[model samples]
Target chain A: MSAALDAAPGRELPVLAVVGVGLIGGSFAAALRRAGKVGKVIGAGRSRDALVRAKGLGLIDEAVALEDAARQADIIVLATPVGAIPAILSRLLPFLKPDALLTDVGSTKADVVKAARSALGDRSECFVPGHPIAGAEKTGPEAASADLFVGRTVVLTPLEENTEQCRTLAIDLWKACGARVVLMEPDAHDAALASVSHVPHFLASVFMAQVSGADDADLRLSLAGSGFRDFTRISAGSAEMWQDIFMANRDAVLQELKAFRALLEQTESALAQGDARELHELLERAAVARRFWGSRSGHE
Target chain B: MSAALDAAPGRELPVLAVVGVGLIGGSFAAALRRAGKVGKVIGAGRSRDALVRAKGLGLIDEAVALEDAARQADIIVLATPVGAIPAILSRLLPFLKPDALLTDVGSTKADVVKAARSALGDRSECFVPGHPIAGAEKTGPEAASADLFVGRTVVLTPLEENTEQCRTLAIDLWKACGARVVLMEPDAHDAALASVSHVPHFLASVFMAQVSGADDADLRLSLAGSGFRDFTRISAGSAEMWQDIFMANRDAVLQELKAFRALLEQTESALAQGDARELHELLERAAVARRFWGSRSGHE
Candidate 1:
């Protein structure tokens, strides 16, 4: 933290550059800007149109090349899709300032941790793996909001190689964005996320597939109401983004899916056998459990 | 429609009786009362406390014994748990008036249809089986709303024994409550609802079971957000009610569950094999299909 402060000299605001200025990245920049903690935000992306749009929306102070942003950044935040993080890190490595720190807001952490090890080599100590568990059905800079991360959980899986100062600085940055930061091992983060996020996305998508594949799909869809709407909301997310998350966290997601399948099979067998008592117990248990969790999470 | 009109005799409001005036039944009574289509609403339930509460809340005009309510009724609406419908219908048979029409708001149609056939015998011609596709997280008479069925689908699966007059009366009743009436065979209603509602309920329950069964459930749940909240909302439904629904619609629910499991297996295999394009295509298909359906359903 002191080293970062030393590099910034007399400036009160830190120089921040956000790579892949989409929803997450743009929101982070906007939040930091609103907090008056960022000196200048340079947006980096493959699309000139998006970068231009982001700047036009005041989500970024300037739009520049990825390497150029990296060279001048005091803190670099990668907000690209999970699959694009590795290559972007590789590209930013050469131009990365000596005192600059790197963090990401990707959905998965273990993959990012591995990518950092391979791409940063000796500079791996400057990188912190993080994921802000916040998103909407829509994406892109236009959908970004300064308050998106407020009251949300941001999990950080810092590498053992990362310096104490680097980790502290990354945590401080997420805090400044109005997020609650929690620390966990990369594997633990992946497993937990597999249960909470990845599996739900896949389940919703599968349910959608089942309904749409039906012979009277249009008729069935016509009868679907609020319950179906909420249940399938996340399935409407971008395929490119979700596919990357699915591919990156394959092992953890597979384990969760297997567990879910076992539960579903149990329910199926109970229903098939006309075991009303057993079915009742299973549903009661789940309903009670969900209510408890919802109350604890303030959702109920 | 003529028979019902003939029975009414004059310009008098119809004498209505509501059996098991919980959420659905109570809502129907309230809506009809609001529309001035109903005269005296006699509430009947096993729970005396519930009946008293319904009367107090104006969900019913008075509380009475089931037999008494059935004797004086011009129309009867059974709004009980699916498992309880059969016995309730049996109990109402001896006390039923010759011109009294019968309807129900059970979640499963086939089971109720079978129950009506067995219970009413020759008088099954006057019994109509219907389901209002509306609900809330809460239950009981206190949760009843006059507009609960407004703009919602009320599916009627009339038995072959049902006279045209009986069917018309039930349709008119639902329409008076602001519901859009759709006629289908009992089996079709069960199958369609199994696809759109029952399976989603169980899937959400099973998903909740999987997550809550984890060793670090508290941690995982804390990390869950709006997506998980919406996906699992149906899982928080009343256990007694859903269990009965699952049991009553067992065959149809099982078929939908099997279909869902097959779709899930496809997604799992794609994820396991690291087939990014396959996963993307699957997700893309689900996304596009959901969007199309959502647009048509006016939910987007």
Candidate 2:
């Protein structure tokens, strides 16, 4: 570790390394830079051109190899796809400084935790799994913003081996990015997100595919209004990212999907039987709950 | 009909009546008034207090009984729930002038067409079945706007018995409100709407119900980001309105639901089997189509 970085310990600004410098990593770097909480940002990703662009856009102070970044960074953020977590963690473990804190911005928690445990072994104490519940359909560094995490939630799934210092620093990092940090068990986080995030994105994609594959797709698209537009908005997200999420969070997502399908079947039965009272009750329950959430969230 | 309305025939501004002065009806009245396309707007609904409020808000010049409005109005708009179409049509026909024109802003056209044919009989020619594909989750006259239909599509399912003049006038009325009017078969409109609008709303409502019904609903809702907010926005719409729509367009909605469920099963199977390629392909198809639509709609 650098003498300057160790001079004041936790009080000093972080020398951050962001692997996979895409939307999530780039935005984190930008947000911390804007808040004056990051002394320097080192970016590492598969694409050299993207890293150069990120540096040109001032999202990073330097573009370096993953091993070099891990060796020097005070804090390392693995912001790659969930499927890449294990491999990347394995690569960085050999060069990671003993005092350095490690965190990630993958969507699913349990899988990432497992991957970290398998890859880092005893060094897993330095890693805190996280997910920032904020994104746009747009991708890459050019779409990154300094305020992307402002007023958003960042979930941290701290491991049993994680020291208090590691957990506290992880929380502070996200908080400095203008996000509210919450602690959760990795499994619980996965299940809850599967219900709220994963399943919704999956359903939207399935619906979009269904509509677009129809014989009269052009006609249907032409007639679609704002309802369809908003309902399917998340389906425009990166396919590889969603694929990793669905695969990584398979069990929880499947459980939620099963529950959702059961509810849908009930609704279909009500409509098929022309049971107006039952249908109205079902819709009313949903409408009431949605309005309550919208009001509380200030999204109405 | 008034002598002033009859004096100039098609050239004179018509005395308009909105059967249910809620968002759709009130907005139509407000938009027409803003465009100076109507001589006066009469409001009629079950809620006298609401009608009075509409009058106070200047959404209508008068509040009267349905039959009274039917007798005086040169053009009448039935904006009541889909289930009310037949009963309202029956009550209005006794007092409706032979030269007067009638239309409706129901979400489903097939059922409305059937109701109009049964209730209006030969006079169905004067009643053009229309569905303006625009709305907000809010209801009542207070939520109405003078430009709600601007740049929106209004589908007119013209009856076989309707005169060319009736169709033209219906088209002109929507055009004056700054909406683009398109002609469609009643059945075709219902099928297309079920695919794009009705099923999406139903699914959103169903998903909302699922999330709220979960044991950890509060946690899930708290963690939900912009995607969940937008995905469930339409679920907050009026329950009674959607109930009426589902019942009225039961067949088409059920068919679309069946198709959607099938696609969802395919996704589930892929996820269960860990078939990454299949899942990626499905997500990519949806992503491409949704991106194209979003770009075209200027929502991205």
Candidate number of the best DockQ: 2
Q: What's model 1's overall lDDT?
A: 0.86
lDDT of 2 by residue, A1-300 (tens): 432234354566768899988888999999877877678899997889889999999999999998999888888898888888888888899998887888999999998988899999999998989999888566899989988999889999999999878887788779989998999999999999999999999999999999999999999998899899889999998899999999999999999999999999988988898999988888999999998998898776
lDDT of 1 by residue, B170-236 (tens): 8888998999899999898889889988888899988888788888999999899878988999898
User: What is residue A188's positional error in candidate 1, in angstroms?
Assistant: 0.6
Could you give the interface RMSD of each candidate, to one decimal? 1.2, 1.0
- What stretches of model 1 exceed 4 Å from their correct place? A1-10, B1-10
Candidate 1 accuracy as TM-score = 0.95
- By lDDT, the best candidate is 2
Error of 1 at B259 (Å): 2.1
Give residue B274's error in model 1 in angstroms: 1.6
Alpha carbon deviation, residue B100, candidate 2 (Å) = 1.0
Which residue pairs collide in model 2, if any?
A: none
